[model samples]
Target: MTDAPRPRALGRKSIRPSLVPRDLMGDEELAGVWTAQVITLLPQAFPGVLGESLTGRALQEGVWALRTIDLREFGEGRHRNVDDTPAGGGAGMVLRADIGAKAMAEAVSRARGDVPRLLLSPRGRRFDQAMARDLARRDGVILFCGRFEGVDERLIEQFGLAEVSLGDFVLTGGEIAAQALLDATVRLMPRVLGNHHSAEEESFSSGLLEYPQYTKPAVWEGRAIPEVLLSGHHAKITAWRQAEAERLTKERRPDLWRDHLAKLGRPEEDREL
Candidate 1:
C-alpha cells in the first residue's frame, strides 16, 4: 500500500511573505508584520471574513500576517488520523493528545519570540474587547481551532494553551471565532484602520456601547439627526455622546454599567441606573 500523502501542510509556513500578490506589495510593505498562526483541521476557512474591507486591505499592505498549520499534517500513521475514540468512551472522537502536541510544537518552532498560543473552546475564558486590546499589543498570536468532541485535556494542560470563547455559546468550529478575534485585534494594529481614534470610540473601548451616530441626509424619513450633533458645538456634542453611551449601557447591560461605576470609585448610592 502507498503511504498517505503526509496529509499536506507538513509544518507551519509563513503566509505573510506571499499574502499579497508579488506585484501588489512592494518590499517596504512587508516590514513590521503582525503575524497570526493558526492550527486547524480546516485551513481554507481562514481570511474568510477577514479578507474583506479594512482587514483585507491591511493584509495586502502587510500590516499583519496569517499562516495556517494543518493539523492533519501531524497525524499519526500512514493514514494521518488525528483523532480517536475517547479514552473512557464517549459520543465522539477527541483529537489525540500526541497529535495536537506535535502540531503545536511544529507551529511554535517556526514562530519567533514569545508569541501567545490560544485554543478556541467553549469552556475557556470569555473573550472580550479588553482581551483583544491586550493581544493587539503582542508581537503575534497562535490559534488552535478545536473540532469533534474537543481536544485532549492533557494536550491543553501540557502545552499551556489558553482556551478562549467568543461567548457563552459554542461554534461548529473555531474558524469563525478565529476570524472574529483576529478582525478585532488586527483593526487595532498600527496603520490598519488608518484612524486611531476610531478604535478608541468603538463599543467596549470605554466599557460601554458606542453612542448612536448619524450622517449626511441629516433628515431621513421624517426623523432628524440629534440636534446636539447638528449644533456644531464640540463640547455639547461630547457631553451628549457621553450621556447617551452611559444611558444605553445602563439600560442594556447592567453588568457593564455596574463595572463602569465601580471603576469610577463612585459609591453604590450614586450607581443607580
Candidate 2:
C-alpha cells in the first residue's frame, strides 16, 4: 500500500545570515508569512513580549516571522561604534548616518518584497489602529529603532524612511515602540488570534473605543451583568454594545466621536443630541 501524503511542516527556510543559532530561531523562513524585520542595538530585546501569548504562538507556528538585524553588527571601528556627537552640539549622541545607511542597506537587501522601512521617532506620525491594519495587510515591515538623541536626518532622508511614533513622548530607544507596533500589527494577521471576530470587534476597529465587557459571576460586587446580555436576545445584545461603544467614545474621546460622525456623513451639531 502507498503511504499517505506527509503533512507539510510549518517551518520556513532560513534565507539570511543571523547571529542567532538556527535551532533557537524557532520559526525558520517561510514564504508568504507576514514578517517583521527589526534593526536595533539590543538584539536580545526582541521577540521580547512578542514571543508570548498569541503573538508568540503565531511566530512559532510560522503564521508570521521575525528577523532582528543587530545595528552593532554594522558598526564602524574596532569597538563597533554606531553613534556620534550631534553636529551642532547636543546633550546626547546621535546615531551616525554612515552606520545607519549601512544597516538600512542590509535590511533592504534582506526584504522579501516591497516593504515599509520605518524609523521610530518622537516627531513622526502618530501610530494608530488604522495604521496597524494597513501594515497587517502587507508582506512585512522593516523597523529601525533609533537610540541616544536620535538618528541623523541625512540617514532618514537618504533611505526615505517613514518615521512613526507611539505618542508625543520619547523613549530611551525604539525597541519598545517597535515591539508595540509589531504586536499591534501581527495580531491583525489571519490565524494569529483564536477568533477572527476579536479583531473586528476590538477598540478602534469601528472608529470608536470598545465597549466594556463582562463575563461570568452574573452579579459582581453588587453590580449585575447588563440585563440585555443575560436576556439571550442577540439583536438586543448587539444594539446595547453599539450604544455603549458610542456613548463611551462621545464622552471620553470627542475627537474620535467627531471623526466617527463625519464618516457617517452626520453633522457635528447632532452629537449634542
Candidate 3:
C-alpha cells in the first residue's frame, strides 16, 4: 500500500546563523510557507507596515514569511562599503557589482523554489495589480532594494533581475517600493485577507478600478446609501457595481478604460459615457 503523506511541522522554523542578529530577523522561516527575501542596505526597515493588520496576522501564523538579507554585510573593507563612485563621473554613487553579487548569492542560497528576483528602479516596468496577482501565485519572491544611483548595470544583467517601478516617480531608495510591492502581493495570498472575495472585488482584479464602497449609518448627513444596494437585490447590486466600476475607470483611468474596452472587442472611442 502507498505510504501516507508526512505531516508538516508546526511552529516557527529554526534560526539560521547569519551576520544579521537573530532578534532583528522579522519572522522565523517556516517550511513550505511563501517567503519574501529582501536584499537591502536597510535591513531594519523591513516588516514596517507589513507587521500589522491581516498581513501581520498571517505572518505570525506562518501563512507567509519575510527574510531580510543585510546587503552591507556583504560589503568590502573595514567600513563595509557597498557602493562606490560611478564609473563615468556621475553625481551619485553606484552600488558595486561585486558587493551586489555577494549579497544576491547569499539570498539565492536560501531561496526555496522558483522565486522571481526583482530590482526596484524608477525606469523599470510600472508595477500594478496584475503583477501583484502574478507574484501572489508564485512560490515566493526575491527583491533587491536599490539605493543611491542604483546598482551596477553588470550586476543587474548578471542576476537577470526583472526591474519594477512603483510609479513614474523616483524614491530615495527601493525599501519603500519593496514594502509596497510585498504588501500588495502578500494580501493576495491564501488566508492572508480575512475575506477571499475581498481580493476578487478590489480595484484592478477585473482590469478596472474597484467600485465605490459604503457602510452603515445607511443615511449619513445629507446622503443615503444607494437604494439599489439597500434593496437586497443581488442582480441589481451586481449591475450597479459593474456600472460604477466602468464609469470610474472611464473617468479617472482612460488608459485602463481603453484597455478594458479593447478586451471587450469594443472601439476605444466607445469609452465615452
Residue 175 local lDDT, model 3: 96
Most TM-score-accurate candidate: 2
Predicted candidate 2 versus true structure: per-residue lDDT over 43-81, tens digit per residue: 899888998899887776677889888999888889999
Q: lDDT score, residue 91, model 3? A: 97
**Clash pairs, model 2 backbone:** 12-29, 12-30, 13-29
| lDDT, model 2 | 0.87
Q: Least lDDT summed over 10 consecutive residues: which range in candidate 2?
A: 15-24
lDDT of 1 by residue, 1-273 (tens): 996444222123233443447322222323345678889999878778887899888776566777888898888789999999988777988999999998899778867756899999999998999999999888789999999889999999998899999998978888888988999998988878878999999899999999998898989999999988988899999999999999898889988888888899875844466
- Model 1 whole-model lDDT (C-alpha atoms): 0.83
Candidate 2: stretches off by over 4 Å: 1-5, 11-28, 270-273
Residue 25 in model 1: lDDT: 22
Q: Tens digit of lDDT per residue, candidate 3, span 67-179?
A: 99899898889999999999979799999999999989988888887799999999999999999989998889999999999989999999999999999999999999999
Off by over 4 Å in 1: 1-32, 270-273
